[model samples]
Target: MSTFYDCLLTGTFVFPLLGSLVLALSYGRLSERASATVGVASIGLAALCTLWVGFAFVDQGKAAQTLTLWHWISVGDFQPTVGLMLDGLSMTMLGVITGVGFFIHLFAAWYMRGEEGITRFFCHMNLFVFSMILLVLGDNLLLLYFGWEGVGLCSYLLIGYYYRTPANGWAAFKAFVITRTGDVFLAIGMFLLFTQLGSLNIQTLLARAPEWWSDGGLMPQLTALMLLGGAVGKSAQLPLQTWLADAMAGPTPVSALIHAATMVTAGVYLIARMNGIFLMAPDVLLLVGIVGAVTLVIAGFAALAQTDIKRVLAYSTMSQIGYMFLALGIGAFDAAIFHLMIHAFFKALLFLSAGSVIVCTHHEQDMRKLGGLWKKLPLTYAGFVVGGAALAALPLVTAGFYSKDAILVSALVSGHDVLMLAGLLGALLTSVYTMRLILGTFHGAPKSDHAREAEAGKGLVHGLPLIVLIVMSTAIGAQIHPPLDEVLPPSVHGEGFGVDLVEGVAMIVAVGGVLFALWLFTRQRGLVRRAVADPRGARLWQFWHNAWGFDALYDWLFVRPYRELVRVNRGDWINTICNVAPWLARLSHDGLRRTQTGRLRHYAFSMVLGSTLLLLFLLVG
Candidate 1:
């Protein structure tokens, strides 16, 4: 018999899946309240189980624990089991997924009150949590891939939850198709890893990789690059990043839980989990850092151009993931995970708080039209400022400062001075965009009736989550420990942190970014408007507004070519074979129809003649 602890670790993923099944099977029969109850209870129980295992793991100081659930797949020499592992890395992710996840569910219960398709919404949300849990806890790479795509599938469903809107469905498809582009690369990489290593079992691979594979091998570099493709798609890194901003069509909870807090962070976790493999390929590691640096700066520029509140948050998510990627590039796996934790808190808080404001304003999302809401929606204002400050990494008292600073410090001292400069520029943007979001929406005078009506629709469920995440955003960093570098490799972290010239420079840049945002977006809003109205300025505005024309580029390059090919082929080569049988049948039937034109006498004559012919042919043969 298995102990509760073993089941508990696995249950953190399974229970939500079970809840999803229940909601799906009983769809439409349950009321909104009932669906919310089941959804909250399912994740709530998962959170409790996480707490249990966390305490035990800490108290006992266990190295790692693997629960063999059952045999999953077998084919002669290839066998992968259904199992769950609890180590420092996975344990931390579990705490984040279940703990922060539970609050998101709670907030959703209230945020989506009386909305249509509530059951369907919760079902997809619960399933997303399950998939994310599987992603973090799975014992093997194949199973992790299952979890990885599961989150992608759930994201599509949730984003298209409001199918009445044509834009929503398009957004969902965009997210699905773009991410799948990366998945193809991941599948190929997995095939190569299995072929070379002879196993996808993570533990075995991690343990035996160094012995079996030489350093600086082409195969390893190729595999790392492919896996990086998968990470880029899921985490919204550059080139594959245009999908996330449009994904704002989903519910606020979906945006918070999937796009911001949990799912988008999967790329960082994947790289961190496979830290051993990446360490062997120095070139690949450097590439990861460069991609992260460029993405952070690009995404920050995109966020600065956004007008919709959620789109700003979406771009913010991409930028933050870039920071985590930079940390991975610098070989600071622990710092990556640390920033991931803090980012989750503040980003989720920001999204949930945005949802509350949206609910009061009757779903208006344009920040230009939303202003002076801080006075009416005090709780939401407080939550937004707290979360934004964390995002900005305000000198002290914010969680983002501790975690993001750790990454900045690591980058500075890692002998890659150029990347350190890139890191500083990105941090400045982070602070700038965060302040832009606050001042444009909350600091200016009320521009519309909706902005003035921000305080009416408030609930305890909504307030509870905002308060919890606000507290987390402010304090979670001070308490964050380094990720499990003991199990993972090439963390490149040093002991004891202190302030120095580099740190001083980073803080000054962050503060300057914040001050500039206030001056340009708040006090000098008119001047900013006049600048944007000019032809050159407007061109830049439109450029960033459309995500650097990536969508248009993909449409022209990929979508149009495939569509034109389909049109040109018309029936295609396979369809030629399909046409032959139909044409032959039509010819035979036409001849037969001419003979059957008259009557019963003609049919009788034909049958007699056919019998005579059959006898003659059989005898001759």
Candidate 2:
């Protein structure tokens, strides 16, 4: 039993559960103000405890620390322990989940003011924090899975927080169904690993994978691919990407926390957490890299055509996560995690700031209708600019520049030149769409009557969280590469691939993207209008606007076929069986009804005939 175990059980895991109990007990009895305060305080304490664990692990100078709580399951030789692991990687994730979680809670308190289900909202939020911590801190696959499902449940509840709206329900269902697809693959991958290695303990499996499957074998590749399926599904990669955009039907805070900062990033976290398994199968890594690059390009283009403010950010989240996947796919696990951390800070800030804007605008999300918001909501506009800079990877202006740029650079050094180029193009596209979003919503003249009244509130409820995120986003770049190396096993850093040239090109692309968006939306609106009027240009715009019709293709390939099979079977077998049962029941009922008619003579005659037949049969026998 390591000292880390004691700290985790005593602090990290226990406190949130306790807090949740308190909140649950106080529900309805306490005032809304009190409940919100308690919710924030609980998560705030959890964040502090997580930070303590991070520091303690760093001070101990250990690569990883595991504490076994109990035997989760035992099936003869198959045993999996329920426990926690405090390592450089888990610590990094824990800090982000708890810390950003605290700010999001604070932001939600104000954003959700006077809304129904406020207590329920706090309950779900606390549970989400607990689940996310479990995800990062778990020592084995089983415990990790418990948290995985927990988050899925929380996401569904929160996405449908406004259950009155049919669209919200649909959004929740879509997200659930899509993520469940990934969870299936995750389960299969875990089973394959355990069947092959006979253990689900992450440390043991990682250490033994090389010895057990060192012949460059198929099982490892198959498992890696299966795991990638889960990552793709959870992270909202291609084919599974549509649900995330629709998930914006939920509250804006839910969008900020789940879709942007925490939940959607789980897939990337899963791959990084199991870097050893992926490292063994370079073929799998290459495939992951390709999928990531493709998703990045496609999602960036999708963002370019979106009209809703949250949808644009949703697609941007997918694209940013794709970059992280590309990093992991190229064996830059640390860089991927680093980028994930930095992306969380800025993306959460963007979503939260967007939430404030949406709230003040009376929930009108069409970017085309919003303009000159910068004047009315200067603080939000400032936050938006910082977030946009981060998302665009604009030079040395933000942490995103350092982390995202590093991923592309790492890919080049690892011999994936095509991916590196695609990644760069994706970055450029990210900038174009993000700037389009900022300018269309806040820069141009107000296209709607509501914009003039939109303003940031004077309360600390909104400003304080944005201020904290701004500070963190500015300083986060310096924190990524150092302390991580001390507590986690150092990742395989590739040779620098022409740092100056790559940096120069990335900066140029990012700047060009921003400039182009500004020019098109501001100075060259006439050009955009002319292009949209032309048939050929309109087709191109439409294609991008509909997410390249990936959803349609999926429907044709998977949904239509499945529904057709059901239709055929319903008519051929199911309907036949159902008809027969009902028809036979009707006949039996009619015959019985006939016998029940008021006819005493018929009854007596039938009784006499029955007695005669019985007597004759007995005599013959």
Candidate 3:
């Protein structure tokens, strides 16, 4: 029998590429349903192949597995192979990418059912799945980069899927520009790694990293920081996070797939994959932790003030990724990955449920105008509760309790007292805002006419993913310790009861946050409204709501300054440089024009003068 690993090595990557080709050849001949079916099946097959490979690797007790198909590029001493590397880290990422990805493709089939460019939508989706697989499976930095840039291209296409909307197009452009800035640093880091280590292979890099560290090389720290820069931009951490809130302008499924499950988590995966490098540079890891902690708190506060349904979820996603980064920074790599996995489940559930809400509500996202939806869409409300519980890290009710609490515990035990406190506060804020979102959107009186007519749809398409995710979310926390430790390295600190403590405290904080939210939004509505409307209260709300104006500061410091420099330099240096060729052409033309007089006398005189000048110069010399 051919095992799943065999199929993964041969089938997963090829299936999507082949399916995409088949769809392209079929082109407009195929109906929308047929095209959507083909796209979904391709990714479905890829997911199966990923699962198979995961089981095979786990069964064989292999820490890492690599399969090389062909030599992609070779120049002098440089060589990069197109290959797949499956490890604990990449395997987890593969599962999320393919599994959640397949579901999103399914959801899109229905979401984009009547849209004009259905075929193009499927095409972009298949390409996205292919790029994500390559990203997770690549054995070297260069191949990974190919997948990285591929996903970026797909993101640009999908975010502007409705290119007619100038806002959507601008949002897509913003995502592209911001992420590309991070990519520049990532590229430089890869170049440095290759120059210093002479290899981009993951195993080889890890094996040689210690030697460089012992020799007092700066490459390790510099490379790690550069990679963090890329992660920050991609994951929407702190300073680079503003674009994600705006990215909700894209299709909801795009938001669920790229922002939630796959693309944003790429940064967390990169950090975990290169944990050995970070381990060698403890200072860099500390910086990662600090930045992550700050992002978590700031984004949590931002989520608290959002009225748009998707933007609220977007901020929550940012805040959640910050927790993963916090774990990574504190040397809790496994915890970070654990939280990432659990986050994929709930975040996808939340986004999809939100999509269904938006679909039924006729695209109205403002919570102020959305109320009393629990009766209209009970299943969606149920999904939201389950997902929100997970988001709040509410004890044993969901997967978040296990993964997120473990992170807080790890922080506390690692003696990062400040980080631990910040994480707890973030957790509280998460509970508050998420519950606020639920109560405001689902539990109150119908604030808008749309909700009065809102009706729940069949649960098969939308509810199935939520159900699957809920089960995974519930089961993930219990599966954390001994089983995970077999593949993952032990926690930085020796094992302790941090998990138990975290769970208990998480329950208390989550309930408190929920109670606080109810008090603020439901019980004390007039006060809340007054606070939002008053200048003093509005100022504080606006500050938190605008992500503490990090975006504005980045614009002033980075975006505005760069644009100004371009304008000034364009007017001065570039204008002069651009004019130089034309100026030279005109000079040559003028010199030649002197010889082009329409008179034989002038021509002869010019020739004699030239000869005399040549002779005089020669004689003088």
Candidate 4:
């Protein structure tokens, strides 16, 4: 049984890696069907492995297990092994990555049919799955960092998959650079841990953290702050979150995989996995909640102003991740992981459904240009309604309701009344924007030729994943929360009238947001348009549309100054100094080439001269 478990653990990541290699080696040789089959089957197999291993682990009483494959690094008293850990935390992550990732891969097979570079697409997708699996299952921080950078690389490659577009390239670069900023902080944190504690093994480092640094001490706060830096960056939390909406430049499958299932959730996974270190750093933990609360409100507002369907979902992704961060911040690790899993289901569904809409409408993604698509694309409409309900956290029926309610409840029970209020407000914003997206895209008459002539996708590949995801986006999916009691710090469940009151308020806010949006879009549509056409209203819309002008502010504060510095230093003394060796080498090369004349006399003369010079030097010595 142990050996079988090890094999399953190893196979979960290996299968996708092997598929990636196969697709890469057979690039352009395999048909689209062949590539898709390999990609989908690989992740599907991994997903099966995850389920088997998960159930077996639970059946065996849910104790944490570790499998050491081999020693990875060795130095003076510093050795880290290539090992896998299977606790409830990692098990939950495995299910999310493989389970949701498999569906995304399957949907891509249909969405990417007849597209250029299909083999390359599958190869990158497979590699992404492998990287995310490596990230969540690694036993040590070093191995986890390897997977961390791997996902960043894959995101860049996939985001710029359409290399023909300069904008896509820039978007990919933006995401890579911004995330790297956070990764550097993570790297520094690792360095500090190893220097002070003499280890990078996660479990060891965490167990020793309390002994090394007392609670609320400078060291603990600094380390936790560094970790938070990385988490916020990867999870698309504030200040570093400007890249996500632009990342919609990638194919919809890439968005679903990266934004919905894997990359964005990595931060939540990190914080949750290291709950011990965080428990000691109370200030940093509270800051985590604050960042989350503020970000959710900010992202919700931004989502409200988005015109692009995928961009709207992108902002919503940021908002949803904020909720996870909120859970993490408030010491509700279980709720965070639970929401992470549930968000994976519904967000992936929404993105895939949007992909269906995009493909059917001739790749038009602007909600303003899409309308009357409900009947033409009933499957997609159903997806939108179901997924949007979950996104909006609509009452008790949606999967999001359970997970999200857990977060708000945690905020209230933790005495973070302000954060709880922010959460409710964000919930209202989420519902409003989600309904705006639905009504603006599908409810009105066809807004353009694309929508008017749209055709729904046919095939099991197209419909099966959506059907599965729709089911998962409901209360049925909420019932399958991982047994996290052993892995994460137990959440404080508030009882009595206050808990019920909070839940009631949350429910009302969610339903009310949806209803308000319905009324505004259906009845006060002209009033809304005219108000937006007003000067002040237009500015507010523009401000929110531009994500509160963060990108512009960043350009002014960082990008512009850097560019100016580079321009000013283009020919500085340092450049001249660095160029000296190359300049001399180039001069010597030219002089030597001149001596290499194609004439026998020239060769003989050069040889004689060289001999004479050598003889003179020898005589002098």
Top model number, TM-score:
4
lDDT tens digits by residue: candidate 3, 489-598: 55665454765666577689988988888888777989988888999889999998887897788878888989988877876876889999999999999998777869
Query: Candidate 2: TM-score?
Result: 0.90
- For model 4, the superposed segments whose C-alpha errors exceed 4 Å read 595-621
Question: Candidate 2, after superposition: displacement of residue 410 in Å?
Answer: 0.7
Off by over 4 Å in 1: 493-499, 579-621
How close is every model to the real structure, measured as TM-score?
A: 0.92, 0.90, 0.90, 0.97
Indicate the worst ten consecutive residues by lDDT in candidate 1.
490-499
- Write one digit per residue (lDDT tens) for candidate 1, span 1-621: 149788778779888999999999995799999999989999999999999989888776756888888989889988998888889899889988998899999999988988998999889989999999998888899889999999999999999999899999999999999999988988888898899889988888877778888888987788889989989999989789989998999999999998555779898888888887888878998899999999988888888899999999998888888989999998988888888888889999999989988988888889888998878888999999999999998877898988888888888778777887888898898888899889888877888888876664467887889888888898654586744755655445444443376778878988999999888876787898898999999999999888788889988999999999989989788989989999999999999789867789988998999999999999999
The digit string of per-residue lDDT tens for model 2 on 1-621 reads 356547654476566666667778875687789778878888888887777766676677746667777887788987788788877778788878888888998999999999987877887788877887788788888888888898889889899999998989988998999899989999999999999998888888888999899734798889998888888888888657778888888889889888655788889889988887888888998888888899999999989888999999998998888898898888888888888889988999999989989988877789978888998888888889998998898887688888887887787777788999999999989989998899889987788877867766668988998998887776454365534564334545544447667878998999999998888888898998899889998898889888889878888899899999897787686688779989999999999898876889999998999999999999999
Arranged by lDDT with the best first, the candidates are 4, 1, 2, 3
Instruction: Evaluate all candidate structures by whole-model CA lDDT and list the values in order.
Output: 0.87, 0.84, 0.83, 0.93
1-621, model 4: which lDDT tens digit per residue? Answer: 389888988999999999999999995899989999999999999999998998889889998999999998788898999989988899999999999999999999999998999999999999999999999999999999999999999999999999899999999999999999999999998888889888988999888988888989888888899999999999999879999999999999999999777999999999998888889899999999999999999999999999999999999999999998888889999999899999999999999999999999999999889999999999999999999999999988999999999999988898889989999999999999999999999998998999999999999999999999999999999999788998788988888888999999999999999999999999999999998999999999999999999999999999999999999999999999999999999999999888776899988987899999999999999
Query: Over all chains combined, what TM-score does candidate 3 have?
Result: 0.90
lDDT score, residue 229, model 1?
A: 92
Candidate 1 at residue 261, lDDT?
Answer: 51
- Cα displacement (angstroms), candidate 2, residue 206, comes to 0.6
- The alpha-carbon lDDT assigned to residue 506 of candidate 1 equals 79
